[model samples]
Target: MGEVGLRTVRDGQRVLRFQAAVIGAATSQRGSSPRWSELVVYRMVDGHYLISKIGRSTVAHQPTCLRVNHRMVPWSKAAAFGEDSVQRVPCPDCRPELGHGIAPDTMLEVTRYRAILCQTAESAAESLMGDRAALLMPQIVQTVLAQCSESDPNFSRYAEADTALPRAWENTTRTP
Candidate 1:
């Protein structure tokens, strides 16, 4: 794994090992319904908005503030106060307009993370639960993994294929 850089530091702090991120049990109770945020919004695996801008203060961060790791307030929940309130609280860095959809770059990143989660779950289900289960169980897997990401950003770091799932058979993009 080390030969290909499968283990690395994430967030400049947490040591993110692929084995630790993808091999664990799903984070939610089996068979629970998906939350609204999990179903409708695209968010970082950690459920925080990716604040990409380097400067500026005062912006709203929905689903939680990345700077402070504050408790996340879902966009819908905050929008309940009206859009004006939503637009008023700017993040110190990203300057997100609360209730707005994710920034495009962030969407791409979130999509990558979601794809990794799906691929890993499918492989795991096939290995442990059989192919039929793999076919039938993706929604459950999505729900559980989404739940996990909401609470633990580390769970989201399975975003990189080379590091997260290194099997030759699993990597469709690799050449022989």
Candidate 2:
């Protein structure tokens, strides 16, 4: 998350900060359930569906990125990543492509997601579990960034250094 050409380097750093700030805000928003999120699904073949993505309403609908247009469906019909061996490519522009959710047709998938929800959020009251739950988020992001760099170093270089990530890390927006 770096320069988007629409803002200065400082503002671009605020981009990711906005996300972390928003999530913290949700945890404290009154009347918000312990674990509630917008589950966007895409219709797959054979009456099956894939959980194309998941996030807060603002994240999906009125977003600065990851935008999509679609009709709604019941969460009961959602399926996890790689579930049922079903693979349907998601839309590229909107990018609602993340395969993971609970489905009514498969109790096993439901149970798996349930367990994941619990381990990550069920014990949010405990605090420490919450700390450990998302330990891999940055690592995963780094992995994705690395893959992108391998594919297109000149473009992906921005994702790695086009921000003042730390006082030490240089914000290299230019390609060599």
Candidate 3:
């Protein structure tokens, strides 16, 4: 462990710097094992601390291990020692427990998917139904337009169609 003595600060606080290097157990079943995280704790504004950050740190999510009496300790056990005993939370960006998988799509992505579905349906109607696809244009438009007060945000992206939307609809709507 190392500490950099007090230095001048913008707010004039004697920021103490300490470092701990921790070797984490390999958490991944497939990817490379968990990498080393070096953590450095900066003093709190009013000396508020959480018993989380301690060792070789990364971002908040990949925070340092907890410590006791200027000695590093495991996070789970350190929490029992209470706030006064703890030092600081991790980077807050580091989320070690969260599994790494395909990031879940946001509502905006869902809306885009809905638009894609609409485009696909339009293509199928024109290709398979031919002249009858004309009759379905108004129905499709109405169905899209009539959705009001609905929880689905899909229409928000769907309705903002390109100017060619109605022209395409008209082309598909004409009777044989």
Candidate 4:
């Protein structure tokens, strides 16, 4: 209905921006930006069930909406909004999709396991690819690591730890 333009939605603390224009629309023929549904979905990059719906011009998620666009951006490039910005409301469409209420300790263990899994994958890729690994390993590792940390709300901390130097024992050997 309204003139199509870019859209933004707040997902938790982050602001996500995506093309309001659909992939194929009459607007494109006119040499203007494409036109997607007035509604757009914004999903959390960490693979969490959290998502948001934004209209032509708004910042907060529309919690009551029963449907949203299927297109998803893996992660958001927009910085988190400041305290002055509107707080995000949880979307009803995605709330039911949250994981079964698991115990906190179990969830912690799961996150740790995922971090280790990422580390192992990196090691394996480096070993198999050898010299050529460096060329693509960063991208591979980062994508895997981001996916693995999907459920982890504290992913930034884990990401920092992942780059830490290997243990002393890993780099040293004892002489007989």
Query: Of the candidates shown, which would achieve the greatest TM-score relative to the real structure?
Result: 2
Which residue window of length 10 is worst by lDDT in model 4?
107-116
lDDT of all predictions, in order shown? 0.32, 0.25, 0.25, 0.28
Model 2 misplaced stretches (Cα beyond 4 Å): 1-137, 156-176
Please estimate how well model 4 matches the true structure, expressed as its whole-model Cα lDDT. Answer: 0.28
Query: Candidate 3, residue 134: CA error in Å?
Result: 9.5
> What's each prediction's TM-score?
0.19, 0.20, 0.14, 0.17
Give residue 109's error in model 3 in angstroms. 41
Better of 1 and 4 by lDDT: 1
**58-161 in candidate 1: lDDT tens per residue?**
23443334554433334444443232232244454565553456442220001001212223333432332233323344453444444444544544633322
lDDT of 3 by residue, 1-176 (tens): 11323322111112333332111111112233222321112222332211111222211132332321232233444333331232233333333342342122100000000001113323422222234333353333333322310212222333332321345557578687
Tens-digit lDDT string for candidate 4 (1-176) = 22235645464335555443221111112222222112111222322222222222112222233333322111131122221222222243443221343222110000000011113323422332234323343343334234333423333322332442344565597767
After TM-score superposition, what is the CA distance of residue 143 in candidate 4 from its true location, in Å? 1.8
Distance from true location, Cα of 88 in model 1, Å: 54
Higher-lDDT candidate of 1 and 2: 1
Off by over 4 Å in 4: 1-136, 153-170, 173-176
